[model samples]
Target: MTMGLPHGLDGTVEGREYLTFRIAQEEYGIDILKVREIRRYEAPTRIARTPAFIKGVVNLRGTIVPIVDLRMKLHQDCRPVYSEFTVVVILNLLDRVVGIVVDSVSDVLRLSDEQISDVPEFEGAIEVDSIEGLGTVGDRMLILLDIEKLMSNVDMGLVAADA
Candidate 1:
């Protein structure tokens, strides 16, 4: 499913929409087009030997969707505690269906290209390439993520390495 984006006369996108959510104390945004649905948190059937971030898979209708905890995947300092606000954001990416666990879901904001700033150089473990950029709206700053690239990363083990 695709979310409409405003386009310029040259057939290029002028602005894009992002579905924002909170991982911990920080706000993050992902391409709205990639989002399928958001559901309340539920314990998924455990799959042994998988990485810690791979919470497990849930049977969504006939499709088994792997659930990844964004907090653990992002290496957040706090241990994840599922609460009333916790949710799963199902995503359709690279022809695969997956779910990501987050603290809460927020607004869908439309941002012009100029509203985004290039990710600054940092000395940390977070993969800089997975970050699309930092978006500013008023006093809020949203860390925009390239979710497709992140899920497709070799470390994720969600897809084939060559994919």
Candidate 2:
């Protein structure tokens, strides 16, 4: 991991590492530094009255961590079966730990300034304000996400609104 202004800042993006994951037909990436570990899909304990996307909690080495399904949260058609590709990405956000279920995790990419582009305004879950930017690697375009913002967004219902 090299250096880039904290969340898609400046005109340049350099050497920052990102962990890529797939949800629905789209590909997304998040900062590798925030990731704690990756675990296989395990049926988490259900907590009543929470949003469907909030898949409840799991015990990771005795620490209970909330699990959120990115696929369901973003309104994507989920697979009826949880296969080997299904994974839970454990992330540490603002000192609190949480897990996000994703279709599959690809690889860690190191991008330079030229490989990245600023986020353009879009009307959807993957939008300018919620994303870090677009990263280009080879012929593939990766939607780099500002995971912190996406997780903390009002619609996500993970954190309380400041209103």
List per-candidate RMSD values in Å: 3.7, 4.9
In each prediction, how many residue pairs overlap at the backbone (N, C-alpha, C within less than 3 A)?
0, 0
Best by TM-score: 1
Q: lDDT for every model? A: 0.90, 0.83
Give candidate 1's root-mean-square deviation (CA, Å): 3.7
Instruction: Estimate the TM-score of every prediction.
Output: 0.90, 0.84
Error of 2 at 53 (Å): 0.4
Candidate 1 residue-wise lDDT, 73-135, digit = tens: 897465899999999999998889999999999999998887899999996546899899999
Question: Which runs in model 2 stand beyond 4 Å of their true positions?
Answer: 1-14, 76-81, 160-163
C-alpha-based local distance difference test score of model 1: 0.90
Worst 10 residues of 1 by lDDT: 1-10
Q: For residues 24-133, write the lDDT of model 2, one tens digit per residue.
A: 78888999999999999998999999878888999899899999998887765554357889999999886678899999999998887678999876687454677888
Clashes of 2: 0
- The global Cα lDDT (0 to 1) of model 2 is 0.83
